[model samples]
Target chain A: MSSRLSLRGFLALSALRTVNSLSRGTGRGSGTVAGGRVGLAIYPKLLNDLSKNRQVILVSGTNGKTTTTALCVAGWGDKVCSNATGANMPAGHVAALSGSSSPHVVLETDEAWLPVALEATNPRVVVLLNLSRDQLDRATEVRSIAERWRSALSKTAHDLVVVANANDPLVVYASESAKNIRWCNIETPWTSDAVSCPKCTQSIVRTSGSWSCVCGFTKPGCVASVSGSEVRIDNETVQTSLSIPGQFNVGNAAMAATALDVLNVDPSKSLTSMKSVTAIAGRFAVRTWQGRKIHMLLAKNPAGFDALLQSLSPGTDDVWIAINARIADGKDPSWLYDVSFEQLRGRKVWCLGERRLDLSTRLDYANVTYEVVNDLNSLPKTSDTTELLANYTAFSDWMQRTTA
Target chain B: MKIALIYPELLGTYGDYGNALALSQRSTRRGIDVDVMNVSITDELPDADLYLLGGGEDGPQRLAADLLKKSSLKQRVANGAHVFAVCAGLQILGTSFCVEGNDAYEGLSLVDVETTRGSVRSVGELLSQVGENKMVGFENHGGVTTLSPGIEPLGTVLHGRGNNGHFDGFVTETIWATYAHGPVLAMNPWLCDEVIAKVTGNNLTPLKTAADQLYAERVTSLSSR
Candidate 1:
């Protein structure tokens, strides 16, 4: 395919590169947003033109987009481009595709922006992950987003493949009208967002491993699934020995492996490549704090938090929960109630962050004892390893402080 | 004292359920014993000294209002049980409120008030003053409530939009309803103590601790911003 760009597209690409370099030269953080904005402002259809001839794969959902995108990039092997950072907006897409000459591109996308990005990329495969309430102060309701996805995917061409999570009712409902779909049975621990069927508003009946509603909406038969650390696709089973420590990551790997199968890639090679990815962006990074090895985990919503809590070892007790209510963290911390913190009934919890008081209050209701530490330096010294779970901005601050 | 948390599965969207936790913690801190009852929809409403309700989405809010209307919840409130309701809970306790387009549901009428959809949804940090006590919390709701004649306002809105853009909440002899839900009682310990005092019919001594300092800092930081 010829990589020819129109005059306006070429100008936008050139402007993006120049601004990116200038932004990095000054230390104004990553130039992804700034450059992408300039490029799109100049040429409105820059993303469409850049991705017209390339085979694009779009990964999107409420959570795990960054990690799943990284896995997909690893599965595609060499000569593939992707947005490795957490930037998933249109500007970020333009920035990632502007300088690459690769024919294959894997991109992470925001849930609300999936429809717009699908139109721009016209992707060969779209991975639909679980949907849940996230940043409700800034985001629309979960059902509204699902409705938008259903409409957008229904209008796509017949050959376009959709990889959806079968266990999540919302995902099944959203991709039901797709021409071709590969269902993956990824077990979801959070079901509050999908208690009512998206199709008929009836209560969903859930068993140990599956869910169905009286309205005829139910979990689809899976073409791909993950059991323990193994991913089963068709007649073959690939062992996923990933350094990332969570069943959720195993489920993500299964989704990536299935998407690779649609692209005619070897599942064994994809699993091998995925094992090399220990951390996506900065999530699941281990850091030493106060003479203890602390595993840092990021959970922006109740569903993500529930997954993290379920993945913890039975013996793991010492925990530090950090919360912040900044602009990027959605300002309203009312979602804390939705999270089941009762699991930490007998654990020692140290509440840290701008909203530590709010968390302390939550822990009090959970019948859990906790200590409020305003300053990180004053955090008590623990000999055993501890786990740190933080929301968006708090996670970023801790990563910057410990890594710097 | 026994505190019943009403329909948590349906009406526990925001951290409004934290109010129950706040009451338990504050009561324990004051040497007052309290038992918390988690009540679901299918279960019968248990009689208690106090009832706690939280906020939720429109569908669940309507379901809760319908369920509570059929039960004897109004008699419990009328018998002088201390009740605290937040956002959707406040709306469900009023005489009537709009749930969605062109549809309204009748509330338990525990308080003499009515609710309608606000012109714009209000979401932000809320600061108010109830008598000599300063109340701080977060408010996110679309219901605009109007109090009946001779009804008392919960507090005056000092910052951000409160109940109808002016008043923060409503209060009767034994019930309190408000849109401010940082689990209102958690951020405003004084209000929690006041509610407890009303239940036990005794003036409880206040204990100064780190929560007060955190509350003060939050109020300062949010107000200045």
Candidate 2:
């Protein structure tokens, strides 16, 4: 601990620790944000102070931040502190750092809070996964977020290493001005948001594996690339065998490996560490519910849903799609139309959620037959394993209910 | 009945494509044979009895407006095509629309209205009353439109900031434009039926489904809120 802390800062930290213990005893919630808010209210710069003498690594983007952060922490081996339960704002960072005395920390940051978190932690490595439209009601335009990121990264004094996705135009455009960058060719299946270049507003030209624009912007030369289950970094090729299913997870693991590489970690040990991570924050977990096997998936935006759709096994048909329009999930449910629910054309889909009607409406247009079940508990019991894909609040609620 | 979805690539933001889907599903339920055509900006405008346009960002909205102006859309609308346009789509069908921090762009001039940026963005649940029916949906836009004299609105704003924080939408004999973009038609089935009745020139039987119950509940909840 830093001895230069003011008396007020010390008092705030003690209060936060007591509040966190009391909240956990009450068993209301994770107590991460609750304790964090208390601490931050007393000292607004608590995160900066807590993060001092710590080598922080921030993972931020529209999606996959949690999984990537988990993977990065695993690659860093034991004694790595992280916000493991998905409480990822500045308050969450304070709560996470306040608990552990580890000098190394990995954090998953929200998209809009990336600049603020970056300034506070001054991380040695910033891993940016990809940028896409998400929660338009709560978030500003995607281009505006990227512009802010570019402005923030350009002014940093330290030699910050940026692990960026080259395939996403927004990510590429935002991190292009960084001095030291480790680009990853992380393929994005959903290209609707990247149709126009963020810099020039012209249609981007995309080939099979690369994308370019009429202006001077294009996919940067990637030092790390993911091909199927294999990751290529420098001259070493490591076949990732993660318990998590999906190419997106593989891309996330590749980014983790590259981040570890920048920290001079052994490649074999990093890959070994990643293979042990079966689930992160309740995602990609196979659980038995009411004697029926179920696979839980979380998709917040069109790009995430598209990737989840592609990850489905060929013979798998039955699906349950739940959507909600809560403040956490964005009050507007219009993004439902942007998803290609047509991919579920022949599958038996059971739409259930606060906004199941919107999902059913989108499914109807996709020419898919669906049954709307208002009560999730009344869903018909099936012998076979079923896939459950839901948005943010729905997924969180389901996880809480099922686990409880 | 043929319905052409115009510039979906550029104008299909905010789930506006749901409007087209709503039309097709309702038409199929009514035993009416509906042929839906998706027309891109580069493609020639297809002649249809009804046309659908969705909302989009400012740049794509301008591109869609420019393309529609140059294409045969104006001619077809002049020839009595029933057109339903949402947020950006509504702005694009008007005479002119001013973007924030940019010069104003020319619209298709198919509707007797003009659009300007509002002082603040209007984003929330919008409830409008059109005749005996109430339409409920989500509205997220900064554009405030003013209609010319002799032109009537689609409905009266019950809640939320409608066009210029007062009226809801503009409606003429063959054109209807609104900012209520909860895939407006899906949440407002009566408006969907109205569009179909205007385009097909027939009073179709009402077909109710589980979706209706959801819509009714949502309307009640939104109105109460």
Candidate 3:
């Protein structure tokens, strides 16, 4: 068969297959396929074709992958052919590539799946969100993963655009291979455990809520940067002016905008788009339940969870921490110890999930006060306006029902 | 006391260090000083009152087990010293770890559990109802560990699991290993205290401060089933 005919035929088959897969996987009890796999298979070829006209941007992290991906895609508008659905894995990228019609693909690649997905998508630009200790049972060690990413970035010939989280030393070293790296950070006052430098393994000092590495390798105010508050995306400084409010979101938005700029998109347009996108389903999503404002932030790992806890202010009328014993939430919930729940002062937490008791006991040992609720259905029905900070599946179901 | 936190280089999963932290905190509370050492394949193992091992990915666990075999650590385990192993660390504490496709690697046999990589990987919050009480924690082990007879399983299975398919704390005299990943000691302060009691045989009083009182009040309010 001729190459052109084969390409057309392949696209057609992939599109059909994806539709079928999505339908099958849409049901609640269906296994993990969501048209993400086949979509990943088609990404490399489709993205390579766009190389003549535009650059590819790949976003991956334990959290914020979706928000950043959306920001970049919305920023590019007509210029980008993206899967901004927050699917960072291989299949998710393929699905996005297959659906997009633009020249550029703004893809979200999973950290665990980055090596395979990169080989498949081969995007020109890679944006790494902060590296946190997440799913220790399945994912590679943070340092090892970073080292692999550094090696992978070294090999990619594409005009490498490294969008980094400056507060995270691990991510800085991960994207070390990309010489054209632009650092982004969260300048918010929500200070937590992200204070170490990845290079010299030295402590980064935070002055007036803004952190600066004393390593001298980072240029003052120029090389090392901040989130929406300090980093200039388009021309505006990165800040919480966007739809998302968590301290991490500012960094995510900044990184997204930076990636767009690297892709030759006008920084102004990117910033404009950045303001329009909000939180993804699990990452700090807000939903109204029976006239009460329910804030939901997916706390997958200790870092993300720590950020969520740090981002949490003193005035949560009621807090519900929903933990799942599912594999996706880390087969072992032992990492919860690292989470400084001590910050959650005054507000009583409604601990609910298969792991509710587990969390409750941990809170008990830490002397954190919490109430245990086993039923997820009663999450909204319960009084005191509970904030359902649930896991992947539980949160998704809760959102769908509450919204519907 | 210097606590040799084995596999810190590979098995660190945030609060994974909390096991050490809790150990350190409780030890300090009882007027015991601890220097928690992070020893990996690259670093030499240190001496301590306790040797701890936590969970990580299969690759790292295998790598750590291989590295531990080459060290001068056997003398420590044989001396009836305190060793706290969780999940992957527990598996490595066995006579041999049978990971699929790989030959069963010899273990320290600090415990009676025999671990082999299983087709089914267990992950989630582990709640085991042991001895009339439910022990709450997390267990994300990819390998299935079977405890030998005469060994007491750690905790009761309230949700996720217990030791050797049993929802109880697996106890083998001086050695203690379990799938309790919730950094093991963070939620189970009693367990930490018990380990300390066994290791040192010191009647250290555990204080429940205003923090503990507040926690009880909150749980009482929230756990209204």
**What is each model's TM-score for chain A?**
0.96, 0.95, 0.80
Candidate 2, pairs of clashing residues: none
Error of 3 at A236 (Å): 8.4
Error of 1 at A289 (Å): 5.5
lDDT of candidate 3 over A1-404, digit per residue (tens): 11322464467435535565558535332212244444334444533332334357778876777778877877777656665545565555545554444567777778877766566555667888867667666665565777788787777664566777655556666776766677665443322233334454344565653455667534223233553355565345533367776766766766777777776766666666677676664455667766666777776666667777776766856787878757666565666676777777677788876667667756655656677775655544553445567766557656775652
Report the C-alpha lDDT of model 1 over B1-225, residue by residue, as the tens digit.
899998776677676666887788778887889899998776789999998888877777888888889887888877778788888988898899987664667887877888888888898888887888778888888878899998898989888888877898888888887888636787777788888889888788877644576578778876686
How many collisions per candidate? 0, 0, 45
**DockQ of predicted candidate 3:** 0.25
- Deviating ranges (above 4 Å) for candidate 2: A3-11, A26-31, A375-377, B28-37, B41-49, B101-106, B200-210
- For model 3, give the interface RMSD: 6.5
- Better DockQ candidate (2, 3): 2
- Report the lDDT tens digits of candidate 2 across residue range A1-404: 65625677788887887798777453433336788889889988888888887788999999899999989888999899899978889998888888777888899998889899988888989999988889888788677888889988887765789999988888988898788899998877877777766776666888989888778788888899989999989889998889898999999999999988988887668977998898777789877777777788999998899999888987647898889999999999888877888888778899978888878867766778898886767787988778999999999877876652
Share of native interface contacts recovered by each model: 0.41, 0.47, 0.44
Worst 10 residues of 3 chain B by lDDT: B209-218
Rank by TM-score, highest first: 2, 1, 3
TM-score of each: 0.91, 0.92, 0.70
